[model samples]
Target: MHSNRRINVDPAKIHCYIRELDRSLLRLAKSSTSIKSLTFIDSELKRVEQCIVRAARESGNLVASRFGGILEISSKGSKTGKDLVTDVDRASQNLIANIMSETCPGHVLLGEEDPPDKKQEASDWMWIVDPIDGTTNYVNSSNIYAISIAALYKGETVAAAIWIPWPNDDGFELMHARKGHGTWIGDSKLHVHPENETGVPATGILSSFPRWMPKAFNINKQLMENQGEIRNGGSACYEQFMVAKGSMQYAITGVASTWDFAAGILLINEAGGKVMRLNSDGLFENFNGWAENYKPDPQTYERLRKWRGLILSGPPRTVDFVAANLSLKQPRLFTRIKMLFNN
Candidate 1:
């Protein structure tokens, strides 16, 4: 039986644990007749990655098949019509969840559309998924949508895959990464633009600050005014992939959930870039810890369901620049007093 106890693992130790687990699994695979000798942990992870990509690819095809047909769209408690959920989204998520269940049994599935059970603890193995990232774009036939999936073992992102349905004039694109194994798009390795070469005047940024979030208003405004160009692709994963490919300097979002940024964070980090939190303080705290120690409880899931706040990511220099410039909007006098008294 799975434990109901909540646990938090240090992010730093996750890679070590995965390595040890890989070694043990390798030995077991060699001995077990049912397990092929090549089915080591790394290969197993890659297999899962491929499975996710396949599911996402098929989902894209489903969307393509329905294009110009009818997309049964609806809102998921968002006041704005831009925040949408569609039949394709649910279908894609269901497909991913089922594949994970069949391929990697016992793993926890935490998806944007289908979260794990509230009674369980954060499992040692957690698969984070965003079935259709750019729902708004997808619904409108913008071709900027993507399916994002990531494997989190004890809080560290072990493997991630972001499948872009229509990457360019060519065809679909798959960006994926495994811990300690560089990020890749198709067969080419991805690298962040060098600090010296990435200047703000020429750099493009993908930013989104929900109109309801007051804290990000001034900061986001400044970003729009100062950055060379600010683009909102409506899909967080795709924007992060653009950053990873050196096409964009940074992707900043004020209201991001785990599924929205999980795969993207790993992608940028593995591509020699940095993902940093942005708030009133300019301090660079570790943002990966929360996911590393996630608890699958109602309270934790409730918090994860809400917007967590702002994230700035890209080349180190670009991240630092944005962090330094962005500051929370100050509360009014009465609001400040109320907040202070409440605190």
Candidate 2:
């Protein structure tokens, strides 16, 4: 009879308990802040860093617990019908939002699962979250997924954390960074491999849409032959983590949303890497200048929600070399017509 019995559990209560624990820890840490020399902005960023780290950890646990189990999956109605959203994704985002609400009240939340109107309220602080960065990977039982959380103050990403599953262990590791503080996995500060600067062959990640594959094939081929091994891990955040940790020399993604790469951008930048994006002029340009010119407003949040672009990131030298060799110019009208006819 005991073997046939089922145990009932309340996920809501458990989530509440976790939120309370996070709040208590935040309070305790704040009380111990004896340094009076820190600027107000710096102090706020430090607190946000602590909160985001805990939020990522808790959200990662939620995602890990559901892996390989029965998942309620749906599509985001994309043209390819391949953009998936699982129940775990919703649960993870909700858990993160709950924690942020309790710990950092009044901050605007820009989450993957939230509607655009949610950002209509203008606020100085914004939390950008991709609860499950690799939902498709998670659904397929791959461990390449990640939880990404970032805090933006005045339209600048100041504190960020990414929770990635450990390959050999059954646990997760959180990689976090503050704006001026170097990226960290625990106490060790992360720095991109200096070998990347020497242009030695090294592993790199490359991704593009299926339609663009033909055009990108030459670049991919050249990279493999001259730059080293080429891979696509399907998760932008995971690829960014690898680059930040010096495991990979660079990563280029043809399609990425703000939430998909916000935290990863900060992590890579903090790790002494560089990031560039494709511009309308058919060239890759430095991407770090946005924060310098950003003007915070409700409309800015709206624009961020709709933002999508090609991003290339890595050590400064490697990124420049890769960008210089890449040919992303759009096809001419005649060329497009000829390709359609050939197809």
Candidate 3:
């Protein structure tokens, strides 16, 4: 019975396991990369994916504990207004980190919810994870939630998987990717929908502003003028999946956490798309400096360590075009505190 059980969630540790998968895929693709046993790689990638789902399930359990069992939550303030952080996030991080370290001791782990204390840069083998990407949705019980995990052997995102436990009834959907190996959601290969007229179509092209950025408050205004459409699904993991799976052109917003976008971005990139700072607008299209820029509240750093908003995903031309237009008079206000204080 246990052997046939289908897993339904994603976990941080999956990033660690992907390192193993990438290694195996490298050899498999080479044909002669290895002359010995081959079943090992096949079995192992499956196992690695299982590890991701398992870890995500554990993370989900920890979150459920907070929602139903614990009320000891605190606010991260207006930046992440109504978003609450709990001991559960820390507890889950610790659990996932320990397991990953033990399994792939050589892999450097960078998590979204809990980043490394030491500021050393990510190296050849790094596991990037967002134990829970949509904390706000998780806390509000409004859906839009997931665990994101990715493997980056160097700065390049190598392989990734996003497992959502609930889709229709908060159930599950699994997406997987490996650099140069193509992307998959379940048994299907993935591709971003090419843009229509602009040659790119981003689903979240004009999602409502974060309620904080005054610069782009008129996103709807501009969308109407440009004759384009925008869509919002809820979670970064989901948005990225849609982009990779070719349902939407791309997804873009602001203020992304490394973990929140890690797995999804990797999936998009490995699938032959792009993700970069909205300011650059290089990933999808080109920036035109049309919309005023917006900065995430500095307090967001304290609320969640690794963040700068997320541009979920989409076709390169389409996304780049939007990013090119969005400009902020006060971009990253928090980072410029020293300059402000000096004045």
On TM-score, the candidate that comes out on top is 2
Q: Which ten residues in a row have the lowest lDDT in candidate 1?
A: 334-343
TM-score of each: 0.74, 0.79, 0.63
lDDT accuracy of residue 94 in candidate 3: 71
- For residues 1-343, what per-residue lDDT tens digits would candidate 2 score against the true structure? 3577688989999999999999999987886673443566678788989999999999888888888999998888665448889889999999999999999999988888886447465467888889898888988999998899988877778899999999646487899999998999998899975654455346443322224544543465555456655677788888888888888877776566778778988999999999887665556788752354455676677777776767788888878877777674346733442332210
**Candidate 1 residue-wise lDDT, 43-86, digit = tens:** 87777677666666666666566655687888876586856888
State the TM-score for model 3.
0.63
Screening candidate 2 with a backbone cut-off below 3 angstroms (N, C-alpha, C), the clashing residue pairs are none
Best by lDDT: 2
Compare candidates 1 and 3 on TM-score and give the better one: 1
Candidates, ranked, lDDT = 2, 1, 3
The clash numbers for all candidates, in the given order, read: 1, 0, 37
The lDDT per prediction is 0.69, 0.78, 0.57
Clashing pairs in 1: 155-292
By TM-score, the candidates rank as: 2, 1, 3
- Cα lDDT of candidate 2 equals 0.78
**RMSD of every prediction:** 13.7, 19.8, 16.6
